[model samples]
Target: MARVLVVDDDKNTLKFVRLHLEEEGYDVIEATDGRDALKKLKTLPCDIAVVDVMMPFMDGISLTKEIRNTYDIPIIILTAKDQIDDKAVGFEAGTDDYLTKPFETKELVFRIKALLRRYVDSESDNDPIRLGNILILHENYSIKIDTKTIKLPLKEFELLYLLAKNSQRVFSREQIIENVWDLDFEGDNRTVDVHIKRLRQRFSHLSVPFSIRTVRGVGYTLEMNQ
Candidate 1:
């Protein structure tokens, strides 16, 4: 089973999360603060971490940065519903995802599963994905089209990799946001549109065999040309 480290100063919150996560078949290790969490990390191997924004001694953002520096596991930050700035800081600190407080247990489970899948994919897939003349190197976060190699930002590379890995599969705007961003992304459909537009602009001049096509009211799909 996947071992999860859950850190929060509130005893009630920790109990609640532990109970629900344990019910979902996860091995949960609880810590009352960031210091305790680091102590636990020393002896325990955790698959992922769920950290709350508010904590004594060390806050979640600081702890996330420490974990990012030391561990390769994914982290999910828990924040208050209105603490938008916390989410931004958490992202900057290297959190893989965030869950707003007053969240459902099912949503937490979903995010954990999603992050695990992504973590595993990155660890296992070392070979570049090739589609005709286009090559996607996941490790380098770059793509090669014909003779030109372009390095992209983290999100752009993930978005392109998602679509290209599942070439010809249609993904709705909501689905794209959920997969590329997070399930709790505060942005709207236009975020996906902007990213899509940027990707198109980047490779518009190339003689590529695949195109990211918009499916009207449906969404976007990377269609391989015949």
Candidate 2:
């Protein structure tokens, strides 16, 4: 079951939400205030959070900002404030979705389900993947470098996408083959090396020289921070 954290100051509201979410087969964790929510977050294994904007100890906006500093978990802000600016502020503070108070339980459950589906489908968008000055837009399948578009081949894009999806994580040739090439690659790790070399050569003219670093004994890592 998917785990969820529900942070609200009102005891009655928390109890109501917890029971409903539990009935839906979700593991629900509870917090009375934003400060307590942050503490719970440190130890709890929650996939998503339902946070109320008006809390006694720390308020949801501040708590959301603090969580965003390290964690990229999905956050849904529950608030009585229905103004556009309030919603804008929530989003600015890294809220994934916003729901107004006096909401129906069915609507709440539907929103949570939709957000979770989107979150699961696009988990890699949170990663930053840089190739030279070119930035791969993981959420959009496009590339932009120095305000210009970089056309990538279909095969090359998949190769780069998989590497970028796990930035700084080294993968052997056999692993890359199984993932990107769909081959039983039993020969050598040099296949990965060749692709890395070609990717680097293609983007070498930028301010940040594009390159993939090779571990002395391991495999290749896509390192744009170099």
Candidate 3:
């Protein structure tokens, strides 16, 4: 059974949602606020989370950022705020989807099922593109060269994954930023350079057939070193 974590300050809402989710054959976990949700995440792993934006001691946006950095689970923000800016902020914080409050239980259930299916299917599709004998696991967020398992910071991992996926295809720095950072980023271009430097340092000792080659005046690509 897929476990769903529902975080809301309103106890009545939690009870209502939990009852419906349980009836649909999902294991439901409850938290009164974002802080409590994080605590639950540390011990109780859930497949996805339904988080409310307005809450005491750490709102849903902040919680979504933290979860994106640490966990691989999907988040759906439940909020009464229907303004575009609010939704933008939630998306920038890495929420998988957004649902405004006064929502129907049927719609909520349908969204949950859809998001889970979408993420699962995408994970299978990515399938860890291999370059120069190095395997990049999209779902696992780790790189493997031979028997060694190397973990990277979130940004560094994302950069590496993108390049690996498009091996031999050059990606300009602008394209890299657009894809990896999305629209909410305000960092300068050097951000990609710094991450590339770190990735090179990590893979330096590995005997891989491919390397991240910098194409001056353009961008970068993972190319065969033959």
Q: Which candidate is the best by lDDT?
A: 1
Residue 106 of model 3 has an lDDT of 95
Candidates' C-alpha lDDT: 0.85, 0.71, 0.80
Report clash pairs, candidate 3: 132-210
Candidate 1 local Cα displacement, residue 119, angstroms: 1.4
Pick by TM-score: 1 or 2, better one? 1
Candidate 3 to truth, TM: 0.60
| Highest TM-score against the true fold, candidate | 1
Per residue, candidate 3 scores C-alpha lDDT tens digits across 127-168 of 877776677886766788878877554456778888877889
Q: Tell how far residue 67 is off in model 2, in angstroms.
A: 1.5
Residues 1-226, candidate 1: write the lDDT tens digits.
Answer: 8999999999999999999999999999999999999999999989999999999999999998888778767889999988877876676566767789989999999989987876656556556899999899887667898889876644567889999988889999999988889766774676677678767887898788889999999999999988
TM-score ranking of the models: 1, 3, 2
Better model by TM-score: candidate 2 vs candidate 3? 3
Clash count per candidate: 0, 0, 1
